[model samples]
Target chain A: MTRAFNFSAGPAALPAEVLQQAAEEMLDWHGAGMGVMEMSHRGREFMSILAQAQADLRELLAVPDNYRILFMQGGALAENAIIPMNLLGQRPDERRTADYVVTGAWSVKSQKEARRYCDVNIAASTEADKFTRLPAQAEWRLSKDPAYVHVCTNETIHGVEYFWTPDLAAAGLPDVPLVADVSSHILSRPLDVSRFGVIYGGAQKNIGPSGLTLVIVRDDLLDRSLPVCPTAFHWKTVAENDSMYNTPPTYAIYIAGLVFQWLKRRGGLAAMEAQNKAKAELLYGYLDNSGFYRTAVAKDCRSRMNVPFFLHDETLNDVFLAGARERGLLQLKGHKSVGGMRASIYNAMPLEGVTALVDYLREFERSHG
Target chain B: MTRAFNFSAGPAALPAEVLQQAAEEMLDWHGAGMGVMEMSHRGREFMSILAQAQADLRELLAVPDNYRILFMQGGALAENAIIPMNLLGQRPDERRTADYVVTGAWSVKSQKEARRYCDVNIAASTEADKFTRLPAQAEWRLSKDPAYVHVCTNETIHGVEYFWTPDLAAAGLPDVPLVADVSSHILSRPLDVSRFGVIYGGAQKNIGPSGLTLVIVRDDLLDRSLPVCPTAFHWKTVAENDSMYNTPPTYAIYIAGLVFQWLKRRGGLAAMEAQNKAKAELLYGYLDNSGFYRTAVAKDCRSRMNVPFFLHDETLNDVFLAGARERGLLQLKGHKSVGGMRASIYNAMPLEGVTALVDYLREFERSHG
Candidate 1:
């Protein structure tokens, strides 16, 4: 079967090896007599799968003993409200406000959703620049005693990313925690888990599939949830139950486990980072050289995972997309908010796929120019 | 590959045909060149899949046009809080109370979760009876001005099913909506959708897989969500966005769509109900006749989907489960809360599987009795 190089953002591509393994084990998982989806969450067979997945993830990210990784649901969107519900109570006597660095569309949504639970202070915002760049940490305004600082390390829609982590201690908010929404670019490289109090992302982009949300939080932060937080979404409750407080997305987690295995075989995140860098450079280099296409985001902060670009001749946009589709380069259409083409080369996207995309880009430019 | 007869409680058995089709389409779906899990939630292919699944479900249950079916996540346990968060505000100015008929473990949990949102009145409870029978409608003492009335129509852990729907209109609470968590027995029989304002279930049992929660709420009930409800969990927002407010569990929905097709091919719920009854009768009939094995739940209210039983000598529980596994009967271990054995013969469990289970039961009884 011919599989296309899918470039859709979030719910994007997964490793061929992972899908192949899943297909083979669909009916009988390790001779367990049933597929992973059919097994009871409490059963020994599924418990093993869950344990392996959690262990592999911890090893891959080098998550410290102080952290608890939660396999949650409702995606990153749901986590927007959940984050505030869990964190706002940390200093209830204080004004119950959190600092937000609004870099792009996702961070904007994040801050807005948090308003439902607590007061939000836009500590820094680059929206004035059309979300084309990340705000410099030096320019961020300090909140006297905010609950936590929130940021979207990677903006899938706006195609901007933070290459460096914010150091709250250096900024004089030593005790204040830093929360990041790393949905699009998680697992692309090694991360200092100690730097952030909480890191969360939707599994669809770089992990496995939609519906399964991964939340990695410092163990100490788990107890700060407000009374209004749903018991199922409570971080402490989920951690205490080992993510089976309710039946987790079993098949999604299993698929994610298969992906973790695939990543490990490929030499983990360091190797994946190298390959991702090469793929991003290959496409970006071609775009930089070609006069026919141009990316709007600032060069230094452009997302290595999601690259949104516009045709030099805006009128040729439809023709460019139609041609890209013909050559098996799919989902080249950009987000409606940003009227241009976007190619999200996530962790699962091989360099060969990016090469094909560059090849198609050159051909389309040569003909259309 | 020899397939076993799996009887898991919630993340239970699925139709073999659906699993086979899913395996075949793992890498590429309908020549789209990417699996369903890999497709964009907004893409034409996945949207068609989402539309068809919703349509098929609407047809299968004869859901009225006023009812909007929502594909959510976090399972029934999460819905426990989400329900009150969305419904408690229906009559905000009033005493802010909701009535609950706690017949079993699930409904008791539901009431406890709701207490976090508003005052919860135990309208009727059979917890005193060990949840072996449904509390009669005549005995219900619902609140005069409740925001809503809640019930667990089928309790998976208790093995009790509500064969009859509770009529709030007949109970002098016409405007107060009746909400039911029909997680385990949702598709096992024909449901009168018009009777309930909200009907929700986790999909793992009879629909497709874990991680997907189905919510069928009448249109009038959507706008009653409290301001504190997470927007992602708001029924109104979800209905307006057609359950696409966030990236949904695409693969799970695709599998559910396949099951819906399988259900339609097998002559819908009516035919499924007949087969389920016959299968339940075969196993329950055997347990009733044999002194060696006895079911704890009342015959009239015993779940056709989940049949919980016990050996006269409780010490043989391990021996019974071991023998059942050796003979390809799986997941017969009952929940720890009510230990013994539970054979969950969901819609996917064929009569032959139940027959095999009965044959094993007879053999075990004769050899040990």
Candidate 2:
């Protein structure tokens, strides 16, 4: 009955209400005599669930009419290759190249994967600064007639985030479409759907669970898939079929729908963003004051969702994690590459969880400082 | 809760016991303080779940040590292209061709998708027979030096099941590996894993849910992926990473693992096969004896998992489904392409459910005939 404040990034925490509702409907969904997982993807009952989920997501994000939202699989990692395959085909006669703004680990992986499908150009990179901040849009080297400009708006591993949408026109790349991997911080705030050509993220972070990926692409971009793109992964085929070209992760979608409903009940993204900001401030504010812990990411571009911080005394890292777990504060261990502690406070994580984490951080520091 | 006998073709019924257990552990799995869906893929808790699921599946199927079981997404449709991409590069100097035995709708789609990556040869096809029967192995005309020979052992749409494995050696294609999409009937019976180089299926029918695809591939064949293969879909990388190269559909995998445990508790595949046989006999026996209903699939090849039948008077089709639903029998409507009724009695469908279905069939016939 005692749930921990789970902070593991991606496949992280989900709303308690969503899980409770799911548990109640596990055997029979809405008296349909079968659980959501057991129902046919094409059945009337599941169709309703699918429709509601899609509609809820659209309303929550205020998705433009010209955009198509696709519930896909293979996570954001698969989309690295899939994105280029879908975009590079738009201009077959032109040079097959795409621009990537590498902020951290995810964008690094994204650009490398796209290299297999097209010539990847790192137009902007914060890797030189150890991915501590987002690269300024003014400093980005524009590519002439590139297929698309890719960016990881939120880097889960490095705890860096883009506070503002990169305007291609401002960067002298007006014609180039901006594609963003917004996996970690998608629903943590309100987004201008019209600002990007395509926005995609795995559902495990701010959404529901892993396995279900949400891709929101402008309708015009749907027809630009390469011949080599798998039929199931092809945006046009999936969009045309209403994401039913393949049997989508039904239960995942249902859970995500439940999450969307929960979000709406909590006053949608604007309210959520406000709470997220408060939670991030509570933790970051404490970290900034404490000499025992130090957050490396720049203040302006620090991810409100994922906060990776290091112990001032590195030797106490193990002790810090062990004590946190004892207090039911879990998954605070940082990514192996980063070698520090990370707290991913996604949409599902309540302020209470953050307060508890901060309390534990202070307690650990009081003893170890 | 008045649970019905759900007969969805895929995304089909799951064991009630598994569903109940999942519900019980929804918010807190094994006192870990977070559900399986909330756990990090690399965390000890979820890793144990992944390991156990893989081990249980390996044990249930008696998969050989040389085989690596991969948990993937994108369903069977995506695997259609992934298969060719992963297999075609074994012989770069030779013609890129793969032989397919198209017996039904799934295999037809499978072969068509493979055409995107390599030359797909229809080695054997029962399309002339309306996929009512499996084409005999002796009749196969496989290509010379094909990367692999593929087959849909059980066609969910056509209700044609292969009672025996196809021996490549007997067909004079000894070295050519055999790949079978056993999606709809995978766990309904004992499988000889050694017979196929790769055995994959969407974990919807005879498994757990939609979204998770299981690929059991022999280790030697894992390294044959083409350069164009997405890293996430590359079987070699997937196998080496233990299917953790991407954030897998964790919750779906957890559910599938629970079903695997349920299967073992139900005395493994041998016991499941016996019950499945009995249930199939009850329904098929009724269909054969009744003049009002007819199953078109060849008697020897009729699937024990999916029984597709038609009303003698086509006008009464709607009435049949309505009555069946009223009697707590659901999803009896056949695929639109086939235009009839299909009762997909997977491993989860008990004999009592089939008996009730038969009772309804008798009542409907007496009332409408």
Candidate 3:
């Protein structure tokens, strides 16, 4: 199974093993005479696949009994609107508000989409600092009894992360729940599911394919949907029906279930967390020491999943990208808004991939300098 | 590439050519060094896939230039609520009203879901007739200046269809637009896109896989969405972004695009319609003469896509199903809501598959009677 290291952000690299298993089962899944794609979602074959996926994910995350796991569609971008529609605006219509802590591009989007559904309060924002760090919890000005506090735990574009969920107890609002968009780094480490009211991530990164959006929410959050919420996006309905209120992206969920199995086979999330940390350290260590490459995020909050680095000589960016592609390291180019190079070493990226990248970084610096 | 014929209602069979092509490109799509699943939706590789899928669909359906084709998620079930959110309640606040014509199980679902978002006017209903046929268009009691009129052009479970789009003028509401859920019978026959304001269906039936939902809407309908509509379900935003408003079911779109190409290779919708008609006639022709089997729907309104038949002696049902399964003619079981057996011969089911089913039906009848 010869394969290249893919580094595209979101719809990024997948475990080679998972892809192989899917290919093998493309025509017939377990002698069911039809592939998972062709099987009815209501049929027993697919129901088994869906049930196993949910159970495996819950076990892996140590999800609390009260949290309902929803396999939704529309990615994290759509969730920017869906999240607010389902969980926010608890009070009478116009009077309800949701507080947002803007860390980077994603959180900024979360707050913007939320504005369509309810009043939005910017509790804190790091845009002034070019999103290199998270806003301190103390500096935040939260609304009294706001619907929920939103945070993007990992900023894919800016390469910043929040190491902890917000502690509103210090702000004298211990009852307020935290909502996080953990799209980029959800399964890269072990997370405390009970700590947050909602934990959502698009499956493209650190999960499985792009169409599937995973939502783990406290049961109570489901019933707070506004009167106007799309019934399909209503968390209570989704959780009650086990995400089968719609078709539920069956193939995407099947792939994600394979990923969960892969994670378990590799000693679960704890092992994956260590491997992710080691891979991140290898790349970050080289960038820190190199005179030709530099990183922008604060040292403490620098994302362990997405390491966005810039070359000192930006003129040679294309040449560097071409070279990386030639060596079978693909999609190393950063986002258009933040141009340079971003090596999104997600869970599927092995330590050897990081080593290959580190070695290339050293060679490129010496030759160009 | 040996494969069995799959007759599932939805998440149904795909073209053999499409599945083979998908398998071949699973690891590296045209040397992009990543599968279509791993490619970014905004990247050139997947963008071409999306653009081609839309263009081919437009050609296949002969869609007008003014229609915006949206590749969305959430299936036809989600469209139940999404349709109301986007089209109903055009008048601001306090929720507007919509008109619904209930012919069968699916139309019942459409109206029930719409009640959550708007006032629903039952223009007409054939449920009193056990969903056996479509009510006469002249009898429909459409609402005055309704936001939009809803219909299930083909009821998958009830095995009934509307060969022609509803004429609002007959209902004395000529200005009202018609919205149709054409999920089961979309590509099985030739259709005129200009007749309806919106034509939507889940991909699994005739398009490709489960996750993708195709929405063909008139450009003018884009801006009528309610303030409560989820932005992702907002037709204007979806049309504006060309369905990239969310990370669409990329792989599903890719597979569907391949199916469209395959359809074109087989001489397009005109050819598909002829084949589907022949397949339906073969099964129906046998049932008509057998006397051992029966079909209850009015012959004029019987769906060419999903044909459900019943055995005269209910006790032979298990034996009939077992015999069909033994011959590899699978998933003939009807919807749970309907007690009889159903055979959904979509575009992917070749005439030879229907011939086998016909031959098996004859043999099973002879052996049992």
Candidate 4:
């Protein structure tokens, strides 16, 4: 494999070993006499593969016995609408208010979709601060007897992350459950499952591929679907059937199962968290010391998975990208809404890739500054 | 590649040539220096690929000028919910209602999901007869001033099909438009575009892969999405953005585009329909002539793609499946609910595959009858 780093936000770089294994198995998976793509989803071979994947993922995350893991389709964006549809039935129809803490673009989108299904109150927002940082949980306006409180734990665009799941019970929100979008940083760290009601993410970033969504939802929240909620997307039906209510995204699920196996082989989430932490620190240390560049997000809230930073001199933007590309660093361009550079070092990214990027950054700054 | 016949029901066989081409281009697509999966969705390379696929599909189906083609995710199951969320806004909130004609499994599913968004009236049904035949269009009790009328043109499980679209206007009913689930039989034949307001299919069966969904919708139905519809799935937004509101199943789209190109090279839909007809005739003729086997669906309403049949004695099911598997005819097992054999002869299955199946059927009947 070439020594290139791909840093696109989602649909980002995959593990080199995983891609190699996928390529090797593309034509025939383990002498099954058919490619994984060609296997019948209901056949014994695929069913075994699906089962092992769910089991491995459960072990890796240390998921609580109370929660059910579901393999779903339509990605995380669809889940924004689906979550509210399934959970808003918790309260009496007239008292179905859901609270949201908007930290960035993804949370804003979540709140907008939630408004369609229930009464929504924005408990906290960072939009007024240009989404440079997540607001402290103490400065909030939470709704009483709300069905659920929603938060995007990792904001993909603005690069802010919640390092810890806030304790809702201690904060006078004991009755209200918390839901989080951990799309960008799901596998980068170990999570506390008992603290949250639902944890969901699109699989494209750290899991395996696009089109598959990973939802870790409590069984208690499974049955309260709105009368108008689509049955296929209703958590109750999906959880009951083990996510086989409809034909799941079979191939994507197969690939994701492979990813779970790979994660387990690499010593599970704890090992991954250590690697991710070291990589983030190395890259952030260089950026902190470099007078030529600066990160916009507050240091405490900055995402370890996504590092968005701007060069002090805007004129060096094209030159910076060109130099980076020449050195085999790819897809480092930041989102268009926030024009700068971004390096999304997800779970698949090796620490060596981060060191290489840091070395390049230091050399470039020395020459330009 | 091995010369095996694949009869998988959905996640079914693809053309051998298509798989070969994909393998060859796995690392780099059209000398673009990146795999199709790795390319940005908004990049020029993938954009051209997407546009060509859409244009060729439009041309092959003789799609009306007013219809917009959308490439979406979440399969036919998601479309069950998406269709209503996008279309139910056509009527006043208090007056919105949709009419459904439930011929089989897929129609029942669509109607069930549509109830989440609109008041549904069952226009026609074949449940009393165990879904063995299509309901006659004349007997449909269609609602006046309904938002839309929906039907599953082909039922994959029941193996029943509507050979023709119902002409609602000519039947003296209000001119409510038609929406059809053409998933199982989409490219198997030519369709009259003007007869339906919306036509959609999941790509896994006859198109290409599992993740991509195709929706051909009339232009007039573009703008009236309900307030609750998620922007990502709202047809109007996807249609306006040309299906790029979210990161699509890019590699799936590329493979589907390749399938469309292959279909065109083999002389378009007319030629395809003839080949499909021959294949279906060969299999059905053998089943009909052999007293040992029987197809339950009415002869006139049998699906050309999915042919579900049963052994007369019911004791030979295991022996039949074993013999078929030994001959490299894979995934011939029927749906669990049907407890028989289903041979899905989609567009990719060659005439020779059907001949082999027929030959095997004849030999088995001679030995066992």
Candidate 5:
């Protein structure tokens, strides 16, 4: 069977070229006589792999000099506790609150896990309107002297995204920093790295694989972790050692590095953003114009990566999915929590994949509606 | 170049056949269009991969019914902090102590990391002897009713191992649990699974790769976690969800499953133990008889996996390493902390590789002498 365009929200589609390159090097990596997986993290070969990966990621993202990119294990779900354990120490006694904006499901999980570490202050929430729109920055009621503000820049399940970083200084917490969970939509657009103190995500989505988590943290944010923070997760220790405090996920990093190289070959993030936006527009534009299919989220807040739409007659959902699967339009079923259809066209998904999905959307509506 | 004999302490040598098989399946796994990395962790394709890996590992290790196997991220280094965090809650107020035996660089790190989470009682340490000997059970001062006793059963750095589990009842700490860090030599030999409360290690050494850490812990040890323990690291949650509390390292687990199948085909751990012992003896026997070479540890306590040997003429160390490398022996240099040479003939290292290494040792000595 030929490769299909995978629409999984996470552990999502990766470029086919990267997979081929990985297969070519699976036995002997660049004449080193050992696969990347078998090379010791401390060895010269894997060291080069790690160094090149870090450099390429920094260049592609145009990441600021003050930021450190760490290749760590455990996904963003684990980082939920790690973020609080690491950042709350800045407040000294863990007495000051960490403000959270609950835009969707991902942000809700982040805040709930944080409560175990410190006092959580709900700065704002849009659940009143069913998380259909990203709450306006003006509606936020931030806590007095908070440690840090948390937000999920893009929600994987609910399909809402904050396309712009909120200006925390203007929002009254001048000294406070914004930490974002950018799991689903990291490389799909241009990000002003200076705006957020920290940006983290599991690599399963736009990155490479499930094991590796990318944490891009500001230099000032280091060395302030609570004493109870695990040494493996201590950002200061990991940053100081260059993410080598422990044995890193070498193969995952290797594959991710290949993906980074691929992204660079395709003209880096700017070009990728253009392609991703065009793909999302093709799908969303049709949904908006189509009478039988409707998107749940507001037009202003619909995620460019994960676009979930409902069929007017929901009973035909199975028939629609079967047809999509048969045509190699794979994993188009929406999350069980939000039942309908979601086409997650991440950075690796070409423009034609979305167009094919759109074609299927109209064809299925014609037959059933 | 063909695959060389990789003598790395970790991220060590893998069976060549396993690497070849992984390469073959790298693009499409069993007709699934997407590679293992791009599949949804919740999808059926990855779920089968995860389940098979767990089942194969359990069968090979003969894991007891009372135990739960957790596939986690973060190597053994992370577990140093995680073990205390997951276990300290059993003490309720973090007042009760955990006993640790500092045998080498690895165990020293385990205890130091545990201090951040709980009271650590160093039962015994061999630093005075310069890590040349393991502390005898009689010399260990068992803490009065400690939470659990921690030991590195196989220390990768200093080349030491406990061939048998220490009897807590005979040592007067009856009914206390034991946690063994078997990172370097897990599948190199057979084990009595019922003898320990938890057996955990990074997969880099003998198991598979660098990302996945296998934790086989007793069922009763679950659910007792400190309030601040990350949900992803919590044993009960991971055990309950079948290590899916967070997305497990999917690709690493897949490769590990393949290694387990390889190990099983070689007649499980017993056959591996026989082969491993022969390989160790073949190298150690040559070192013992050679006037130019010498081993540091006591004969009875010598590791069957990591064989660290020193050249009698220390000036010829660089010459020996260069000569060995020219003959396709790789990463044979000892840890920088203990500079000489270490040959780790793990499960995947056939007896012939050890024979070749011994031949190289003699060839280098003949010229240098």
Candidate 6:
């Protein structure tokens, strides 16, 4: 049977080709007599895989020479706490204050976890707007001499996106660094790495799987961990050891590496950005035109990766889901916290999958509305 | 195609039955329309998978009601630092000392990493004896009021096993709890859960795969994490959330759950213990009898799973490995840290796989010894 278009907000759909390649290589990776999962993490085979993955990702994002990429574990949730522990000590006088722009649930979580290790300042919040929009940079009440400014560039839950990177330097916070959690929309577009101090995400979305996390931090931000920080999690230690200070989520890393290779073969992040934009546009265009579908987020702020739209008649949710299943579209149910349908069109999602989903949506609207 | 008998130290061989089932379920888990890797961790289908795995594991290990089973990420190496961070607050007023038994490389790593969190006391060490034996309990220089006495009960590299749990109460350390890193030999035999405060292991060796870790912790040890502990790594937070505090390594956990169910179907840990004994006996008996092969660990302390053997003539190491590979016995190469071959026959290794390896060993000896 052909695989369905899985739109889970993640542990979500991987590219069918990538999954097929993985299945084929499950037993032997390139005639090495061992699966990528079975190879030693330090072995030449895995090393080459790791190196290529880093290079490809860096190339795709145009990550600068001043930045170091670390493949870590425990997802972005873990990094929320890890980031503070590593950076809070950059100022020696006290636990430095870190500013957060709370756009949605993910940023809220990052802010809360950061409070355990640093003095967190909520510079701006979309909570009053129910996390449906990004706060304008002018509204942010950032701290003086903050360790870093944090933002969730794309809010997975609220389906909100920051179309452009926030400019801290232009906002008179030139000395402070900006950290972004781009978990859901990380690889869907090209990024200007020099504009941010740190960018991290869980691989469950566009990368590969749940066990791997990707962290890109500027080299200048290295080695400022508080004494209380666990050595395994210390950015300096992890960076120096080349993410091998601990046994990494080796298999997840290998799979993500394969995905990076896949992305490159498909003509890099620029091509992916175009494809993702097209898929999102096709789905949202249908939703916008239909009287039966209503999207919650402001049109300008709507996420290009995760588009959450509700049926005008909420009772039609069951019928909509059933129709979707019959058409081999899956995980279309939105987060229970927000009742609606969400289509996550990550880089892995082809235009055909979105087209199939859009066709089903229109047919369902014709019948139900 | 048949798989070779892989003897990798870790990211090691899995039960063939488990792999077969995993492959069969790779596309859809019990008709759920998603592979374990692709499912949202919070979905009901994956929840049932997670719950059954935890429950089955609890029953198999005879874990008491007071203990919490945490399925975590990052392997045992990360636990080295996480453990101390979580446990050192046990005695609030005193600067708690965590005693360590350094039998080999794993314990030495544990000790070094623990220093990052608390004062470490080397209660006992067999490194002076070249890690060929476990030090006697009487020989330990126990620190009074230690937070815990830590030991790597089975050293994978040294091929040393503690046949008996240390009687710390009788050794004048009654109040101190025991923590064991049972990564290599956790399920090979029955364990007294009442004796250990905490036990953790990376799943790749005897469990399922590389990304998942199994941590069993006693009730009394749950609440004392240092304030500086990363909330995600804190045992209490992880236990309270039932390992769903974050997106888990869903695929690895599902695979591990399958292995647990498979173990239950085969009469649980007791049957596994018996089979492991027979397999170890067959391999060790041949090694003891063959003058060409020699095992350095004391016979009484020999590991039932990992058997490291040296050839009398070291020059034929390459030839021995090449011959073994030719006969479909693969990864017989020894760790670079410890020269000579090591055969890791975990619970996944059947009697036949061991016999095949032994047969290859004999043939290679005849040709090159």
- TM-score of every candidate relative to the true structure: 0.99, 0.99, 0.97, 0.96, 0.98, 0.95
Best by DockQ: 2
Worst lDDT 10-window in candidate 4 chain B: B31-40
Q: TM-score, chain A, per candidate? A: 0.99, 0.99, 0.98, 0.97, 0.98, 0.97
lDDT of 6 by residue, B206-241 (tens): 887787888999888888887777788888899888
Q: Is the docking of candidate 2 incorrect, acceptable, medium or high quality?
A: high
Tens-digit per-residue lDDT, A128-222, candidate 1 = 89999888889999798889999999999999999999999999999999999999999999999999999999999999999999999999999
Show the lowest summed lDDT stretch of 10 residues, model 5 chain A.
A88-97
Top-down lDDT ranking: 1, 2, 5, 3, 6, 4
Residue clash pairs of candidate 2:
none
Complex DockQ, candidate 6 = 0.53
Comparing 2 with 5 on DockQ, the higher-scoring candidate is 2
Candidate 3 residue A303 C-alpha distance from true site, Å:
0.9
At residue A140, give the lDDT of candidate 3.
Answer: 97
Model 5: per-residue lDDT, tens digit, B1-369? 778998988888999999888888877788888888888888899999889988888898889899999999899999988898888786766466899999999999999999988789999999987788888888899888888999999888889889768889887777788999999889887788899988899999999989999999998888778888999999999999999988889889989999999998999998998998888889989999899999998787789888888999988888888888888899999998888999888998888899999898888778876
- Kindly give the number of clashing pairs for every candidate: 0, 0, 0, 0, 1, 0
iRMS, model 5 (angstroms): 0.9
- DockQ of all candidate complexes: 0.84, 0.86, 0.60, 0.45, 0.84, 0.53
Interface RMSD of every predicted model, in angstroms:
1.0, 1.0, 2.3, 2.6, 0.9, 2.1
- lDDT (tens digit, per residue) of candidate 3 on B1-369: 246777889889887777778877888889887889998788889999999988898899999999999988888888888888788645854438889999988889889988888889999999889999898888888777788899999999999998877887777777778999999999877899888999898888988888889999998888887776777888999988989877788999999999999999999999999998889989899999998999999999999989989998988888888888888888889888988799999999999999999999889888887
For residues A166-226, write the lDDT of model 5, one tens digit per residue: 9998987777889999999998878888999999999988889889999999999987788
| CA lDDT, every model vs. true structure | 0.93, 0.92, 0.87, 0.85, 0.89, 0.85
RMSD of each: 0.9, 1.0, 1.8, 2.1, 1.2, 2.2
Chain B only, TM-score of each candidate? 0.99, 0.98, 0.98, 0.98, 0.98, 0.97
Is 1 or 3 the stronger prediction by lDDT?
A: 1
Model 2, A1-369: lDDT tens per residue? Answer: 389999999799999999999999999998989899999999999999999999999999999999999999999999998999898776664589899999999999999999888887899888779999887888888678789999999999999999998898877778778999999999899999899999999999989889999999998899888889999999999999999999999999999999999999999999999999999999999999999999999999999999999998899889899998999999999999998899999999999999999999988888878
Show the colliding residue pairs in model 1: none
Better of 3 and 6 by TM-score: 3
